[model samples]
Target: MSQWFQLGLQNGNSPLMEQLTFFHDHALLIVVLITSIVTFFLSAIFVNKFLHRYLLDGQMIETIWTVLPALILIVIALPSIRLLYLIDEINNPALTLKVTGHQWYWSYEYSDFNDIQFDSYMIPTNELEQGMYRLLDVDNRVPLPFNQPVRLMITSDDVLHSWAVPSFGIKMDAVPGRLNQSSLMINLPGVFYGQCSEICGAGHSFMPIVVESISSGEFLKWLESQI
Candidate 1:
C-alpha cells in the first residue's frame, strides 16, 4: 500500500500530488469506518427502542437524543483534533522558498540560494498544450530538489491571496505586511501545478503556480542557469 501511495498521479506529473490525491480519495474511508460503527449501534438502539417502545417523544426519547449526539461528537472530535495538530507541527526543513503575492502575479525567491527571484504569470490560452491547463501554467517555474524537505514563506505585495497547491497539502495565506509559512517534501521529480486561491482582483484567477521538482544534479543546473 505504501508502495502504491508513492506512485505519481495519472493526471498530474508530481509524485507529491499523487500522495495527496490518495489521501483525498481515502479520506471518506475514515469517515466510513467511524460512521459505520457509530451509526450501526445508534440505529439499532433507535429501532429497538422507538419501533417497539410503549411511548413516543417521551422523557426517555428526549434524554437519549441529547446524550447520543454528544457521545457521537466525542468520538469524532478525537481523530479530528489529532489530525489538526499534526498538520500544524513543522519538523526540520532542508531549504526555504519565499513567495510573494503580487497584484496580478506571484514572485518566488530562493532563500537557500543567492536569493534568485522570478515572477510567475498565467500562460496565455493560445500557448497552452493539449494536456496542460490554461491559467494554471506560469512564465517561470520554481525548481527544487526531489525527495527533499522544503520550507515556503508566503506574503503579499498588495491584497490578501492564498498560496494553495492541493497536491502538496499546502495552503498558506499571503497577507499584506505579514508572512505565513508552510513546508513540503516531494519524493519524486515532476512538475506540480497550483493557482492563487484568494480572490484579490479581476486577474486573481489568472495567477498560476508551477513548481518543477528535479533530480539534485538537474536542480543545480537549473539554479546555475538562473545565475
Candidate 2:
C-alpha cells in the first residue's frame, strides 16, 4: 500500500487523502447514477406527453418531482454525514506540527522536535528550477515520516488564512488568536503542495505550503539536521 503513491491530483499519496478520494469518487458516481435514472425516466414520461398536449397537469408532476428529489437527498445525506464524522475524529498522533499564518508567509514549528522552527517562502516564477512549479515551490518544506500519524495545530498571526492541500484532502483555517487542529495518516511517501486560501495582505499570493513525506530513516536524519 505504501509503494503506489505517485505525485498527482487525484492519486493521493497519503492515507487520509486516499480515503477521501475514494469516498468522493464512489459517492459522486452514486449521486450521478441516481440523477441520471430519475432524469431519464422523467424526461421519457414528460417529453412526449408535454409535446402532444400535456396529459398530466404541471402541478401534479411538480409535486412528484419535488418529493422524489427530497427522497434522493435523504439517501445521499447518510454517507455524507458518516464521512464528516470520520474527518472530525482525532486519533493518537505520533507527532504534532504547529503552523502559524503570517501576513504573506507561513511559519512552521516542529513542537516535538526540540522546537525546530522555519519559514516557507514561495519560489518566484522566474527562479523555478527544473520540474518545480512556479508559485507552488517553497524555500523550506515540512518533513514527516511516511506511514505515521501526524497532527497539525493551526492558527493565524494576523487575519484568516486557510491551509489547504487538495491531494492530501486536508484543509483547515488559521484564525487570529484561535487554534484549530487536524490529523492525517500519511501512508504514502512523496511531496504534497498547498496554498494560503484566505486573502490576508498584499503578498498573500506569494505564500505556499509544501509537505515532504519520507521514509522513517530519512525523517530521523532530517530531524537531526534541524537540531
Candidate 3:
C-alpha cells in the first residue's frame, strides 16, 4: 500500500521494476537539466539589459535550438524503446495462472495443477487482524514461487478491468470475451498488492490483488494441499 505523503515510486521487487526506476531517474535528470537551462535563460533575458537587435532573427540560435531538442529526444527515446521491448519480452514460464475479474472480486485458476481454483475477496476493515492493511488485504492470496517465470492469462467475466501491480511493472486490461496475457518474475519473497485500475462497478474498490511469493518447496506443498 502507498502512503499519502510518499511522492516517490515504491521500491521494485523484480528486475523490470528496477529498470523502470532507473529510467525514471534518467528522464527526471534530463527534465531537470532542461528546466534549469530554460530558467537561467529567462532570468537572464529579464535581468540583463544587453539586447542584440539580431537576437530576434538569429539563424544560428534557431538552428541550435532545433537540433538540440532533436538530439535530446533521441537520447530519451532509445532507452525508452528498449525498455518497452524488454517489458513485452516473455521467457519460458514455468507456471500459468488464469485470472478472471468479476464485478467486485478476482478469481484465479491454476490449471497447471488439477482443479486448483479460488476467489480472492478483499478483507473487510472490521474483520482485519493486527498488522493487516485495510482495503489491501484479501481473503485468498495468489501465490507464486520466487525466482521463477509465471504467466498470467487475464480476462473479465462481466465488464472491463485492468490488472496492475506497480512493483512488477505489469498492467494488462481484462476485457470481456477476450483474453490478455502478461508475464511476471518475482525475485524476492514477499507480498505484492494491486487493484483493478479500471472502474467496473459499484464494488470496484473492493477488488484487490495480493500475490504472495514464496519458496518453491512451499509452493509445491500448497499445491499438494489444494489437490
Off by over 4 Å in 3: none
Ranking by TM-score: 3, 2, 1
lDDT of 3: 0.91
TM-score on alpha carbons, each prediction: 0.74, 0.82, 0.96
Residues 1-227 of candidate 1 have per-residue lDDT tens digits of 11246653344233445545655456566678768977987888767744645334488878877898787677656656665565565688778899999988989888877858888888899998788766777778888887777878999989999997766667788999998877677766777877888899998888888888888888888889888
Q: What does candidate 2's lDDT look like per residue over 1-227, in tens digits? A: 11256543455766677777776776688788988987997888866544534435577777877898788677777767877887778888888999999888899998987769988889888888999887888988988888888889999998999998777778899999999998887768888888888887888888888999899899888888877
Best by TM-score: 3
Provide the overall lDDT of each model, using Cα atoms, as 2-decimal numbers.
0.76, 0.82, 0.91
- Lowest summed lDDT across 10 adjacent residues in model 1 is found at 8-17
Candidate 1 vs candidate 2, lDDT winner = 2
Candidate 1 deviant stretches above 4 angstroms:
1-51, 54-67, 129-131
Weakest 10 consecutive residues of candidate 3 by summed lDDT: 50-59
Superior candidate under lDDT, 1 versus 3: 3
